[model samples]
Target: MLKMMTFFQGLPGQQSLLGTLDPGLSEAESEASMSEASSEDLIPPLEAGVTPDGEQEGTSKKKKSKGLANMLSVFIKGKKKKDQPRSSETEVKSKARPELEGPPPTVEELKAALERGRLEAARPVLALERELEAAAAAGGTSDEELVRLQSKVEALYVLLRDQVLGVLRRPLDAAPERLRQALAVVAEQELEDRRAAAGTRAAALVDTLWRGGVEEVAAERLGARPAGVPAGLSEAESRFLHMGRTMKADLEAVVERLKPLFPAEFNVVHTYAQSYHQLFAAHLDTLAQFELCERDTYLLLLWVQNLYPNDILNSPKLAQELQGIRLGSLLPPKQIKLLEATFLSNEVANVKLLMNRALELESQRWAQDVAPQRLNGYCHCELAIDIIQIISQGQTKAENITSDMGMQIKQLLLVELASMLRSYQHIFDEFLEKSKLLKNYRANIIANINNCLSFRTSMEQQWQIPQDSPSHLMDPLKELKAHGFDTLLQSLFLDLKLLFKKFTQTRWAAPVETLEEIIATVGSRLPEFSELQNCFREELMEAVHLHLVKEYIIRLCKRRLVLKTAEQQQQLAKHIEANAEAIQSFCTQNGSTATWLHPALPTLAEIIRLQDPSAIKIEVATYATWYPDFSKGHVNAILAIKGNLSNSDVKSIRNILDINTGVQEASRSLFSLIKVV
Candidate 1:
């Protein structure tokens, strides 16, 4: 029974015993009965033919055990047969279970899982690195986690390195479009993160490099170079070159380390190089704030502009970073061209400082001299030309510089020339003031004016200043011409006014000789007048003509000769006619003042011919109507000239002239006459 129970429990199908043993008993009761029966029937069954007896009990027990063993073997054999079917059923379930399983992992899912792991591991390091950068930038000490994160990042990189490289090397062309895009995006993001880390490290290293007076250290290193090397590198230039090289090497190392981790299209080298350039540029900007000589500043700027690799400007990424830089301010475009030309020609010795020093000394010499000599335009031109010549000397060897660049240099020199012209303006003003007292005032003014004008002309001719030269450069010369020549001409006109006044007072009727003398003085200096000759001639002629007419009118009023005979009256008439003709001829030859002057002449002659008081009154009234500008004093003078007329008669004539026209008519007319004069 025990053997049967153990065999039944061990069989794959054991629950059948409960059904086989119970017909009316409860299931739990049947199971309990069956279990008890199996336990109590532990003794082996007696042999098939043996009887139970005390003496034979032991032998019977052995025989019963043998027969039970045989029955147990048969039951065991039946249980093995039943277990075979269960094993086959288990095999069927095992085979079907695989078909019920989910699908295989997709490429996107794999990439997502990969990125998750990378970001999970890298997030803490990225956060700690950002904190470290902020601390460094703020001049604070780093947190302890920074060191730990550094190692963690290194370890993470090692772990993800193969995966990252595999993604980078994956053949996207062979992959499905969506999967390829997913992989590419993941790879690019990873590369970007790696580049960011490298940049942060490089920036920290640059900060360390900049400390301890970078310029001083570079100068020491440069001095240690062989004696055969060119000497005299500026502090800023030496430091810039040294720092650039150091930053380049450091960035290159960072790139080399990261190169295998990114795709070929990532251009890691360009990324690091751009960062290096930006770092170097910032360092240069910091150095720029220090006090430096012009030459040293120029050399530093040149090193930034030309000595560095063209890649700095050519790379789109780096170019974007440098867009805000004003390279022209440090070294002007023309100066840059000149320096580049000098370098390309292998004539590395810069004499610009020496040339500027010489120019400054030469400019100072002008201040030491007296008035006119100090204002020497020729000296100004020569100094300017010397500067231009020095610039041009470099241009001769400048195969790299463009013609437009050469023109730009000349234009810049012209601007310098304009600035220097300001110092001489006061000298010209002084000369113009003192010139009023000179006997040869016109000649002195002409010489000075010609000196400046000719100098400008020659400069334009020599330098080939186009008509469209930049207005800033030409404005100075225009101002000089406008102010200096105009002031001088005004002074000459003032002198002419005095001379004409004297001529009117002393030789009123016979004034052609004095007028000729004035015209001859101006005409003799015509060559000096250059562009201003026409204006000077027109103004002088007008002045002389008006003065001559005014003097003739005054002389006619002042004459007090009574006509005692017909011959005297005839002579007076002829003299008046001749004066009128001379004025008319002069007016016709010069300008248009003769319209009123020619009419006045005949009226005055008509008055002289009329001898009777009543006839003279009628003649004077007619003349007054014809020439309304004739005043009461002019009528009185005419009447006084007739020696027969009394003061009362002169007064009566004035009253008649006034009543016939209007009250104060003669006074109003006199104002108009004065305006004409």
Candidate 2:
């Protein structure tokens, strides 16, 4: 356009003048000189109006100008590649190829092609690979179709690798944009067709002994497994998962059925673990009663045992310590053993797990709350009562019961209690008697054990109770049946009665007066002998009083109370009638003395009965002293003193000396010596 302005304004000479004028920049003058020195200096002017006038007169030339303008505009619009030089491919030699193949494409290439085509693209890919294999073996390989196939595969692989890897990293909640777009474009019927294909693969995996590809080819393609897990586990896992789902589903059913009655009795935080354990056991136990055709007992047990030990017990270790054991307190040792042995014996590590868990549970101690649920046990069930009664009744009638066990158990548990109430009163007396014949060890010393009640309660509640206690402690009846506790209990009650009976008698109670009478009638009296005699009298008196009080009074009162109450009387009468109560017949006493006597007896006769006449020492009767041989002399003196007391008052008088062989000699000596002195 500047050159055109120059032509209109003044011509070439004027243009040169404009060009030579001092411009704002020296670079501008030098640049203009350089441009003029090149093209303009080299090209001479064309002959004026020569071939150009003929060339320019035609219509075709105008058309050609118009076409050229359109072509120039198109070229300018798409000139991005024109500025860059292109390399000649054929002139560039490729690297040496010595490929030989059965099927040319590597597995990776084949997979990429298939995935890129979505499985349909593999046929052409595989064909091209075969051609490459053939051509390589022939030492010549080229075809436009094969080249096109290779190009398509290369492009497909690049696209497919990127897309598949991206899919692999995609979050489960969302797929890639490409996949989402593809899925959106898929017609519903076409989707059903693809699903049917996936279904066939899965169906193959369902067969037994299905192996390898059956799972991978089947599960992944079908998306059967949720994540990375295999499509199936053992039969056991299936059953467990099934039962878990069933239990969860039926929970609402159970709530619906039980909510009206509120079976939440076992649902408190206080007993939640225990209630769960029991319910687990009970559900299975009850389930065992039915014929479950589809279920396996071993499997259910495995399931429950698995869940309870770790999930229930160990998961929540006691966070708060409770003062007492919160569960399994009343459970028997054998039951606990069964649990340990069956469920946890092998999992020795689980013991600590459970202990720590118990600690955790203890930490989470709930309030001692009883708002909605009562703490009462359902063991008040009729079955419990029926069982206990059966034990009680069958226990009494069984002659086959182990008779000895009762005695052993009584010795174990009740001896201290019995001794507490039955010890001789004289056991506490401060009395000392000197022996007459023995050279040494003469004195008989006694001290009271009356204030030892503390000893008694401790012996019973603490020692005996703690020894057996809540668990491993043997069952009283099981021990009874093993030990025949029936006899021991009965004898214990009887002895109590007899002791009460003995405490009440007052007749012949004055043993001192009777001693005076026997001495006066039988023989001479000794001076200063009252003191020694008084000690013996005091001991005998106390024994007689205790025996009478406990055997007679306490027992008689107890029996009378029983008869006074209508319930007791009726119960006793009915029991006796029902039992055909066994009665002991009279039998000879052991050795030389009767084991029992009439409730009331004269002192002289009682003394005679207790004495072994063959063992009596006559010299002891004369001495009026404690004999070395268990005090035969003392025995004779007491008997001689009480021998002739009247029948009406004989027992007390006889008992005052507490007649037996020792009293017999002692009494005689007292009778004779007091007179002689």
lDDT against the true structure, each candidate: 0.44, 0.29
How does candidate 1 score on lDDT?
Answer: 0.44
Clashing pairs in 1: none
Whose TM-score is greatest here?
A: 1
Model 1 segments more than 4 A misplaced: 1-235, 238-271, 278-423, 430-508, 511-514, 528-677
Off by over 4 Å in 2: 1-123, 136-149, 156-505, 508-612, 615-677
Please give the range of 10 consecutive residues that has the lowest summed lDDT in model 1. 1-10
Question: What is candidate 2's lDDT per residue for 1-677, written digit by digit as tens?
Answer: 11111111222233322232223323233333332232112112322222432233256544443343332222212222423321211111121233434534443444544455353333333333233322222221222222322333333333333333233222122233444332222222123223323323222221111122122322232222223333655544453454343333333332333223222332312332233334445545554455433224334434444443333333333322111325432234454345333322222233234333432332222111111111131101121122223222322222122334223333323332232222222221111122223221111111111112223234445344443444223232223121221221233445444333332242324323432342232122222112222333233323222232223212222212212233433343343222111110111110112222221222212333332332223322322233222232324333333333344343333233334435333221212222110
Q: Which candidate comes out best when scored by lDDT?
A: 1
TM-score of each: 0.31, 0.21
